[model samples]
Target: MQISDLPYTDPGVPDARSGPRFLWWLGRNQAGGQLKSLAWGLLHFGGVMALPYGVGFAVQAVVDRSGGRLAFAGLLLVLAGVCLAFGDTMLHRTAVTNWITAAARVQQLLARRTAHLGSALTRRVAAGEVVAVSTGDVEKIGWFVEAVSRFTAAAVTVAAVCVALLIHQPDLGLVVALGVPLVALGVLPLLPRATRLADVQREKAGKATELASDTVAGLRVLRGIGGEELFLDRYRRASQDVRHAAVRSARMWSAISALQVLLPGALLIVVVWHGLGLVRDGRIEVGELVTVYSAVMLLTYPLRHFEEIAMAYSFSRPSAKRAARVLSLERTTTGGPDAGPVADPAGGADDPRTPPSGDLFDPVTGLLAPEGRLTAVVCGDPDEAGRLAERLGGHAALDEGDVPGPSVRLGEAPLDALPLDAARAVVLVQDKDPVLLSGTLSELLDVPASGNVTVDDALTAAECGDVLDALAQASVDEDPMAAPITERGRSLSGGQRQRLALARSLVTDPEVLVLDEPTSAVDSHTEARIADGLRTVRKGRTTVVCTSSPLLLDRAERVVFVHEGEVAAVGVHRVLVRTDPRYRAVVTRETEEEQRRSGSTANSTDAASPNGSGPVIEIEETA
Candidate 1:
């Protein structure tokens, strides 16, 4: 499709078998645009090749002393000039259109693939590599796509020009014809080395970008732990490696550029020197000598396209390979012992479109939450809790090595077997890390929902009134929802961020909502209020909370104690705490920590404003 028709209804399934195959798929999809570009390129290069012929005819007309012929030749030159102007402008126009549309298509495909893979993408592919694909790699791929048409036209023009010379003057034509091929093909030997150097440069640059990204993301933590200098030193070393690799790649490309110029100049000299001898021997006229010299000189312009095409391929091959590699990551369909074989295309499914509604079951862990119940899972390790939470949402740790058991199913329908979007509509997962995107508070909370829970209801359920007060105190508008959240909600305290994220999640009100340590950042009183609010708001809907907090666990109808990665006890929270020693140890440790944190909070509150009405501004440091 053309650039104007962009944002395709479907970018279509990419043939990501290899780098070349992916590129070929892109070209095939944009065949119409490529053909149009080729036509314009032919028009432009044809006029250029005709210019020297027009000039030569004018010179011959002058020697014959024919006024009419001279005027006619001048008219031909004017026509060629007009053609050159129109054709050149349109060729460039079409080329850019091809480039933009191709890049847009690639971007769409990458975005779709990322969505399908979910958290698994960063696990399998480097974050910096994904960033590079979206930014630099897409541009390189588009450049190669746009260059193909122009390169074809230039190659054809060079061949046609040689054929014309061979017919007009065989003696000098033989040398010119053979020399043109030599000039174009001479750089072939240097290409393999150049491409290898470019690949090395790309790899080193990706590592440096990843390192810099990590350092920035954890800058606050590094400074707090007195480890900023350590990471900075590591990053500096990575940057130096990238710089060295870039220099090596640049040197190889520079050598290739030199060869292109050197070989073309040599060909020009040979054709000119030979043509001059033909004129001296009376084998050809003076005008014919000038014509031969002008043809060789003008041919250099199109000849440069050879080197450009080579360079474009060198950069884009790796880019296409990377894009293909990311696009090929399939969402694991086999979530349980009975999960059927599935397509390799990420998120693709041949299953029945209808999603079933019933109890949520994970066969691997033998955990079952009957439909319309709030179930609490007590896991000692936060890492294990996070993985369990993700699995409940159909995001198993397949990339990290399959942990045997867990294809979460809703009744008879397997969640992972469903299309990714369909699976998400069934279950929503919120991890301990609450990443609030930068935006107005209203916008941040605006997400796809079942509409069963309103914004006010969710905010109340999350016990975020203090968060609202914090926003209102900091805002010029005095409207808490209108207040802006800076990147990652860095403007808010840890507690405030957690509460706001809970509000956002509550707004969705999915069929099965899985929360991992949702209230860990908040104080005991707030956690108790949140636990009560959650039970009220989520009444008669399936919910799973992976937490050890007694406040939240006490609200649950049932608690499942998981030890050594398997179900250890299943009963009411109070009964398990009293009867199950292993379960009690995990719960007791968390209870002790919460009590200590509560004591610290009471001491801090005692020293606050005398009226106790003053807002307690808690940054992450204070929290």
Candidate 2:
């Protein structure tokens, strides 16, 4: 494909049968670019082989005192220089294009798989391994793909040059041809050991990356529990292992590099010594001797491609294997690689049996959220609440030891039976701690919307006026809406970040919005404003919020209290609080302490914690 057609609309189904096959699949898809690179490489190396012949002819002409022949040699040298300049430029251009396109294809595929699998992708693969495949592994895969065409051209050039030499001067040609092949193939036997060392280095490096990612993701919790030094020491040890492995791999490659130099230098010495003998005995002209010497030097250049291609393959093979493994993963509900939605005998105009939109029902918990209403789910176990939220979003069976739950259904159609994108479009599950990707405010808020909520409205609904003000303050030179956010929104307070994340979810305006502890970080005052705004904006839309906050539950149209992993009761928030002692205990574990600290008439918006959310929420969750 041309460069303009990038970010491919469809990267096509990958041939993920094996690593070698996956690599071959990539090559076949980009045949046009590969062919272009190979053609240019041949032209470039063909010119490189001509320079020696021109120099030798010029030398002969000079010794014979032939002005016409020397002029012809000069003309040939000029032609060779032109070819070298143009061919080399185009060769590199095509090679780089090939590399970039291959990487882009893999990135697109990974992104698609990531979106489809959701959190389940991480369940099957290590976070560090995924990170490596996307970053360094991607570059290595591209490196090998780009190296193949150049290696082919180099091989052709070597063969062509050897044949020409044999016809022109058999004496020096035989030794030159034999020595060059030996130099290129001699390192083949050392490759298996070097590759093994490199693989070890890669494994250790991946583990270290995974450790760093985990530490960063939970740094707050680690600090709270005073486990920072414990994790830090573990990371240090992992990093040290990576360093040791890298050194071992580097040493082997260094030996290979040394051999590359030594073998070529030794071959050059033998050629020079033989040429000198031929010249002294008057068997060949001085000009022929010069031609032989320079040709031997030129052959050294193309021979290096053999070593480079080998090293490229060695690194890239593992990367391709890892990529293939990730791509091969399917959601258990997805059945297998070729599975699709099961067709219903009672069909409608639509192809799949998936319903357009309706109530979300979880049979395992007997929780039913009616269409065009807001429902609040209260469970004493925060972990259980999180898992139920995951199931509602069509991601099932993530945690172990939990009873197998029935598939959540939208109308009569099971959510798991629907396509991932279709399900995501209908149900938006915002976890308690949602991630805020680094971008401008506008970019962050630019999500698929139902045209029902504007950015201003969403921010207002989520009580994010202070969030906008903070962003504006940070980016004084730019528009407030265009202000840039730091990675994970770490620059903002936890409460402020939570409010912004709430605004983002509101912007999506999906058919079924599932929010887990959407306002746990916000103060009681802001939380009340958010509850009011959320109710007003989502007046007729189905919204499921998994939270124990009284303000939010008080605002919900209906409250479904789950007890012992089953729906124990369903009614208004006040009714549940008054009638259900279990639900009251779950929602009001620290209400007396919080009220005493903040005073009853102050709207429950405690001023003790600057970030809106205080230690009370955490204490209740743990209790």
Candidate 3:
């Protein structure tokens, strides 16, 4: 596969039985590239091996004083030089292509797997591990794959050189031939130890990477809580552990390198010593001695590949294993025995049978959401609220055996029973902390534009007009919506980022919108505006918003109070606030927090505007 043919529409299914098996799978996928690499490798190594014979024949011609033989020897030398130059150049080109193509294929597979698993991928694998596998691990795997053909060609060339040596001088050739295997296999005893060190180093490195990733992602939170030093120290220790492991791993490989050099030196000495004896006994001519000696020296170069292949395998084995583990993750949700494929929802939300626009039921929490109504779910335990929201979207957490439990049904059909795309289309779950990708504002809010909602409509409903104004202020020349956003919208305030994410989800206009605290980051006034806009935009559609804010709850048509992971009460927000003490306490606490924030804001505004010309928004309980 070439780089031009990359980003495959469908990266084929991978073999995930084991690391070696996965490597073999990659090789199989790029069989043509591998063959080209192999052919180039043969040409390169063949030319290298011919150098010794060219020198030997040239020496023989000089001794015989035959001009014809000398000319033939010169031609042979010229031919070897041409092969060397051409073969080496092409070998490098093909080798790099093989590496790039292999790495690209693995990266594509990873990206495909990541898309298939969606949010579950991060939940199952560490963010750093995924990053590591896609970047560093992929390159390592490709290196081993690209190295294999060269190693094979080297072995073949070495064997052929030994055969030629034996034909020229049996005594010295036998000594050199026996030493060749010894040099190649001498490192076998140390391989297991080396592999163990490499594994340990990789494991520690992954942990360090994970720690660093988490630290960076949560740096803002850490600073807010004055825990930056604590996390910094933790990362420091993790990085140190990685360093120590790498050093230990290096030591073992260093020993292997020492043996590589030492054993070859010993073998060279033995070959020379034996060849001299053969020359003294007149069993081998001086020219034969020189040829055998040259062949042995040339063989050393190919013998180094044995050690290189071993090291590459040791490092790549673990990397491929990690990649395979990630690739092995399957879509747990499948249709039931009696279930059939759900029809595509692309046409419109006209079909009542499509779950997203249908009534929603969460059997786990015993919460029922009526179709075409705005429902609010409030739970004292934020964890329970989060879990319930996920379950409501049919995200059944995998059990110990990696199997999904019962699924929530939409429109009388289990959501898990629907095709993954169909299920996602029907129910869109917006997490409490939604991610805002780095792109222009347009790209950030670009979803499958449902004809029901336009970009401007969704952004206005999300109460993000001020956000656009702020972005416009930052860049006067460019359109605010066309301006670039930093990763995760870090450049924007928390409230601004949150509203943008909501706008993206709003544009989709799924049948059932499951939002976990959509307006939590915004102020009371903004939240009220958002709540009213959301209610208006989502009229006659199933909307489940997990929130406790009085402003948002008061706007909901129905409110479900969940306690201890079960629905405790179901009524309008006013009725629940008056009757349920637990519900009242949660809302009351949030009200107190909002009041304190408003007072702080008012004090700051008073100081900044001594003339009191600027307007100040006050917090209030809309309910």
Candidate 4:
């Protein structure tokens, strides 16, 4: 089956049984390949048993010296060698093929599940755990799956060899046959303990991986705040813990290995001792005794597989559990009756083409962002506004049981009811500091849209004309319009990065553009130009700017003041700033003194210096 056909339906809440079920489901999907691999394994291992029996016949013929049969015995020995050589080669080939196919299937299923989960995956599972599952867990699962057929074939071969020995010489055969199984089964009691140790080792490794990922992602901020050493120390501690867990797991595996070796050696010794006695008593022919010895020696090959199967299970079980946890995460489902196709506010749903509604409303916050208008949200705390923007964009889950205040309706249809692709098509949330991936300027602005907004137009709209001039003056080989932007635009100044991100967002020309503090980094001159340019460029499209910037606020048609996360006042920016204390407090930095005192003393001292340089600088004046 194609990767696209794999089921991504949420299996509901995961339990202990989920891991095994996931493996069983994978096996069922690839049953045809699995069966073929099994058949090949049996053919290969069956060949292994025949070689030893032929060797015994050759030895018996040599001992008898009867009627030129010695020549036939030599032929039997040569045939036995050929069968073994061919069987070993074919076994390796089939097993490797099975391993690769199983790994590919699991990888595809994971990719499909990840796409379905989207952002919800980060919320449910640590980023490190996801990485581990995709790479290491997939390998472990493939190892276990591929081992299954070989394990079965090995068991069968062992039984067949034992039966062959019993028919040739019952006295020695019984002891050899019985002892091999006892040696192989002896490892079973240690498996549970070994598995537990392995689980602990895996958990510790996952935690260390998480700590490292977090440290790397935040390394810049950590260094800026002089917390790099602190985080480094913590990571080192986590690494040490992982090492300890790994050592413990290794110790358990070592004990199991020792037992596997000891039991097999003892069984071999017993078979040899008993067979020699039977040879001396004249109760068994020399050729028959040779056959019994050959069968006993062949038993070791299958017995080794038993130990390997145990090892595979010990590693794979936890990996499967991790994969199942990721697969079980459920995406938020809008429970309302299907509202049918969404109508465009500008035209009818039956129309072939129309711009979808740009309205965004939050039931929890009672915030209404109307369609085809410029709106500004002024929040007392910038962090709160940023979080609210994520909720409004449907990137996060809202608290249940709260009144469904104002569903973000596209005409009569709720935004929540729309598919992710459809919703993204209508509303785009551009962060104050949106990430700019490494690419040429042209590539960065390459968004999904019909019209071509020249690089000059986007730059003008974001007031990035100066940034273009700077790049030109630098004499960079790349064109200003085609200049490469580094990852997160780190090469550019804060203002340049902010404008470039805004330019990129504008290039999309989304129906509803929700930007958080888009102009906070730019100078007043650039901010004013951006505000004015935005008004003209997005005149007919809906735009929501979450900023306390007076320059941006003046350009907005309506400004909503958010107090304690709820809308306290809504009107023209100047009107609310004049009448409302909450609006005045937010836009005018009324709490600057209180905020300074609460900040770190060292940073406060730097801010109060006569030179006007500080680690914790405030941009409240811009607002």
Candidate 5:
């Protein structure tokens, strides 16, 4: 099956049955292969039992003094050795296949779920948890799945050996068989405690992984603030906690292992002692006594597997439950009839397919970026604006009962109705500090869909011409377009990274490009060039710039001022600056004290100088 076809819809309120159901689903998906593996396991385990029987016969024959049959017993012993070797080889081969296939299935499921959830997945789950699930948890799940058939065969084989021994010497066989089970049962009470400890270890490990990821992602900023050592200290503490938990978990398993070895050894001793008595009393023939003793000894192999299977299960069960939890995350619903097959948009603009809706209306803030216009969203509180943006992009669900306005709609279509790919294609929401992936300048600018827009043209529009020149001046052999950017564009200045990200978004040429403070990082000259360039590039298409930048606002056809996350004012940038007190207080930030207010920064004078006729406004501070 294609990776895209994996089920991503949550099955709802997972219980004990969830893990088994998922495994059963996997089994059904690979029914033929699983059956073949199971058959091989059974054959191998059966062969394992046959060897001990053959050895017993050989021993009995030596004791019987049957001179002519002595060579026959020797030949049987040789054949038994061959069977044991063959059984071991086949068992390992089948088990490995089961492991690899099970891991592949889980990987496919995770990939599908990640795509289905998109950005929401990170918001809902820790980044490290996702990484751990894909890596460590997947392997543990495979271990349990592959262990299932071998465990079953081993159990059955052990039972059969016990029965055979009972037939040969009822009293001794019964004691050995009964005592082995009692010792195995002793582990059950400790199982819950062991699993709990294992869970704690896994949780701490996940947290440590998350801290490491966070530290790496923010390494540049941490260094800039001289806080690298602080974060490093915190990460070390987290790692130690994980180590402590791991040691605790290992102690439990060590105890379990001790029991596993001790119980089987004791059982062997009991069987040997009782069998010697029977032989001395002449209650059984030497050959029969040998057979009984061999059977009991053979049982040891399967008994060891029993312990191994138990331990494998205890470790894997928690991992499977974690994977199941990830799989259970519901795909965000867009509450409309599925968009049926449409002609590929790649065919041409005139193809029967209509461009998807691009309007974004938010009920909470009563904000609307009407179709086909340059709109500005001015939020006094940047955090509130961020929440609105998430909801607008359909990355989050709104509590409609608590809000009292129309939902965000793309054209006439609800944002959720459009498939994730189609929605993303139509409306690109650029963050205030959009991440620049590690790549060459050309590659960074070449986002998913640029249509006929060339990389050079996108860079010029975002006013990154100078940035490219700087890269070239550094005597770098790499083409500016080919230069390798560090993660999050740490290699470049903040303003340069912001512009590059803008150029990338501009290249995509989506129907509605929602940019959050696109020029917040750039200086006046570049900001002016970007404002003018955006207007020229986005002429007829709908573009929403969520910023308090007066230069960008001046270029916008409509400026919306948001106060306490509500549309407190809306008008031309010039008109709002002159008339609206809330708008004036936010945009002008005229006083020195106002600039120092929490979360507010000195507004840049870039736009006023460009047009040469507007009042000055301060820029917003970035997190």
Candidate 6:
């Protein structure tokens, strides 16, 4: 691939069975580029080998005292110099291009996988590990891939030099040739141990990175609780552990590097010693001795590449493994809904077996949300409610082939059986603590234009005018939409952030909106306004809100009380409270909390609304 064709249009499905296999896959993807690199490397190293031959010719010409031969040798040396310069330059160019292109391809693959899996990717892998795999690990894998061609060229050059030396003098060439293998193979025993140490260092480094990421994410909370020092100490210990591991790994590699130099140096001495003895016995000429010595001296350069390739393979193997593990994750369901309507067996255009249109049904919890109505679910256990919410989004199962027991059905069709995009488009589940990416308010609200709702309408429906006003207070420009938001919206108050998230979701206007305590961070008054506005704005659409707020429940057309992972009762807020004692207790607890906040009498409030909604207090409060 050319440098301009960076970021491969299609990275294709990766082979994730093992690290070596994945690396092989990468090599195969860019076989042409690799071949080009190898060709350039051969030319470059060939040029280097020719310099020793030129020196041998020059010495012979000087010994014969022939001006013509000396001039010829001089011309040959000049030509070899030009080849050396050109070949080395092109070799580096091709090698670097290979590295960058390989890295870009892997990055594109990672990005595609990340987008396809969405939040599910993080559920299986740590955020830090994902970051490391995409960044540092990708670069290391590319490094190894780029080094392969150079290593091949070095091996070929070593063989060619051995042949040339042998052609000159058999006995001297045999000694030099035998020493070549010793220089390359002597350090094999140290590789396994070095690889192990490197793995340990990488593992410890990943943990430290994860710790730092989470700590940075929660820095505000840490400072609020005066636990910054405790976490700092923990991070300090983690960093020190990484340091120790890295040092140990470096020491092992250092020993290997020393051997690489020492063994080759020893061989250099032996070649020179043996070449001198050959001269004394008249077995080889002085010019031939110089050529053999120069050839071995230059051989040191390529032999070192053996060590480099080994080190690259050792470091890159585990990195590829980590990247493969992340890429292997798949969504719970695979197939999307078939295009067009269901067809009848009689070959008619309309299918009688079409799914029925009605309430959203969950066989697991035996809960039903009436079509085109606002429904609130009050679960004593928040965890159970969250799980149910996930089921609504067809994410309860762990794999596509795994039977989704007691699956959720929308319009009579099993939700898990529908196309993933179709199901997600129909149902948008907003979590309790929604994340707000770093961007302007307008950018935050900029989702695909699938629904009719606009940013202004959603903000109004979510009652976020106050939130916009609060954010505007800090901006130089008065327009809140133009103001910048920090990562995760950390600069905003919890309630402000929650309102902004709610606004962003409302803009989507999906057919089925499942909100898991969207307004939990806001006060009762703001939540009351949001509840009323949410119902009005979402008219004629299915909305399932998982919450226990008496105000929100009162606003809902129907409320389902979930107990012990099952729907215990379903009715209006007032009727269920009077009929089901468990439901009454849940609403009553929220009522008392409201009463305490407002400093009002419980009996008076109970008599005022008999609906269990407590008093309608609309006092404006800053988030």
Best candidate, TM-score = 3
lDDT (Cα, tens digit) per residue for candidate 1, span 1-623? 66778798999999887789999999998898889888988888888888888888889889989899889889988888888889899999999999999999999999988877676577678888999999999999999999999999899999999999999989888999999989999999999999999999998888888888888777876887999999999999999998999899999999989988898899888888888888889999877777777888889889989999999999999999999988877766664455644323223245444445689988766678878999999886778887777778775434323333546778877777765776787788888875789999999989998799999999999999988898898789899989989998877777888899999999998889999899988899999999999999999999999999999988998788776666656777877675454566688773646545545334434323444223222111111
Kindly list the per-residue Cα lDDT of model 5 for residues 143-227, writing each as its tens digit.
8777877777777777777787677668777886797687667677777888899889988898899999899877877998999
The better candidate by TM-score, 4 or 5, is 5
TM-score of 3: 0.86
Q: Cα lDDT of model 6 overall?
A: 0.81
List lDDT for all candidates, in order. Answer: 0.83, 0.84, 0.81, 0.73, 0.72, 0.81
Q: How close is candidate 6 to the true structure, as a TM-score?
A: 0.85
lDDT of 3 by residue, 1-623 (tens): 67677676676888987899999998888788878877887888888888877787888788888789879888988898888789889888888888888888899899878876677667678898998999899999999998888888888888887887777677877887788888889999999999999999999899888998889888877888999999999999988988998999999999999998989889889988988888899887777777777877877788888998999899999999999988887665746677655656665557644344457887777788999999998888887777777767664435224756567877667887776777778788888888888988878877785679888889999999999988887765758987789998888878888999999999999888999988888899999999999999999989999998999999998888776666766777776665445556577764646545545434444322444222222222345
lDDT of 2: 0.84
Backbone clash total for model 2 is: 1
What are the runs in model 1 whose C-alpha is more than 4 Å off?
A: 334-355, 378-387, 395-406, 523-529, 548-557, 561-623
Better of 4 and 5 by lDDT: 4
* Model 5 pairs in collision: 334-416, 442-481, 602-619, 603-618, 603-619
Off by over 4 Å in 5: 1-24, 338-352, 357-359, 380-383, 395-407, 432-435, 450-452, 473-478, 486-490, 523-525, 548-551, 562-566, 574-623
Q: For model 3, name the residue pairs that clash.
A: 356-426, 356-511, 356-512, 357-511
Q: How large an RMSD does model 6 have?
A: 7.4
Count of clashing pairs, candidate 1: 2
TM-score of 5: 0.83
> Where does candidate 6 clash, by residue pair?
336-419, 337-419
> Distance from true position, residue 37, model 1, in Å?
0.9
lDDT of 4 at 453: 59
Question: Could you tell me the lDDT of residue 584 within candidate 2?
Answer: 69
Structural similarity to truth (TM-score) of each candidate? 0.83, 0.73, 0.86, 0.79, 0.83, 0.85
